[model samples]
Target: MSGIVVFGAGGRAGRAVTREARRRGHQVTAVVRDPRRHAGIEADGVRLLGGDITDPRAVALASEGQHAAVHAVSPFTGPERGFAGLDPEFFVKAAEALLRGLTETRTHRLLAVGLFANLKTPDGTPVLDDPALLPPPIRPFALAHQAGLDRLREADTPVDWLVLTPPARLERDAPRTGRYRVGGDTVPDPATARLSYADLAVAVLDETETPRHHRTRVSVYT
Candidate 1:
């Protein structure tokens, strides 16, 4: 089977996608900023390589001949880390590099993990606009994520891309139920909308192996 190259392989979403891809018997190239720091991700049928997601040449080098690429790279890990040196255009730059590099390598598919903050409420207000739903301090990071999504929408590249946005309550230790529902650009019932990282991986690989959504972003939840 053709391999899948995953950027930000050390991250939670990226790691889950890598695990699910291997579980489905596909070769995986796990790209991170430092391979030595992610030795735990190395295993049978997986190759760990160091590369920068914001660099087009590095993206092409890591993604050459792969079946698809997953963009799970995030400049901001968490709120405690704060936005000390956050670049507002981080995702925009990533989108540009991925489009250029993937098109150059002839890789036709790009699956990106998206933030739920940009999703709209029932009344059509973005989740990021609601301070109760999303803290005010985190708005910058969410906006950065939104910029990347916008960049993809504005591009005319041949690379087929999809962004899967998970709910706010993504449980790290929850079991994989192997089931999920896809929704539009609105936040599902915040009370009941939650997803396991494992199940999110299932949705990601399901779309990767047999894409049902194209050039669009969708919310995935349990």
Candidate 2:
């Protein structure tokens, strides 16, 4: 069983990934900002560690001795879920911290949960840039997500990383069919933009066991 550390384990995507990893009999560590808030993350054979992904030292300590680290951290948004509540700096800082932590902990692989907006359409245009597809209010958050992706792309580091971008409609609590399609850069289905978080976790773990994308992004959808 591979030793895995999941950052932002309290989030919807993170929880699903953690559960899937454990179901597969892997040693899973759920790294959260506050362990107290996520008491349910504690489970048999699962380790819970408290840390902030924005802090390099914290991330290093959490990542130590792990085979792979999954970055499922997202930006902190407010009620508006718009520009006013968007904080892109969080993602950028977390990306930097993950890089530092991987280097320090000797964790060679990283699997990041990326944004669908970063994927390009058939016309080679970023989906986030299309106003019709993405509302104005959510554009800032999407752009911020893009910044984090840029950090991973620009960083010259030894860590083997793959950013897995999900479809626009990521459904939580959906069944894990373990059936999905993977594509590069382009959105697999513009009309049917949907994917289950459970399946997304399956995709992330599949890549962890048999990595196919390195220092690049891939799209996954049902």
lDDT (C-alpha) at residue 213 in model 1: 97
Deviating ranges (above 4 Å) for candidate 2: 77-85
Superposed by TM-score, candidate 1 places the C-alpha of residue 88 at a distance from the truth, in angstroms, of 0.3
lDDT of 1 by residue, 1-222 (tens): 678999998998888889889999989999999899999888665899999999999999999999899998998778898987889999999999999999999999999999989888778888989998899999999999999999999998899999999988888899999999999898767546899989999998999899999999999999
Screening candidate 2 with a backbone cut-off below 3 angstroms (N, C-alpha, C), the clashing residue pairs are: none
User: Each model's TM-score?
Assistant: 0.97, 0.95
Which ten-residue region of model 2 has the weakest summed lDDT?
76-85
Displacement of the residue 170 alpha carbon in candidate 2, Å: 0.8
Per-residue lDDT over 60-81 for candidate 2, one digit per residue giving the tens place of the 0 to 100 score: 9988899999999875533255
Leading candidate by lDDT? 1
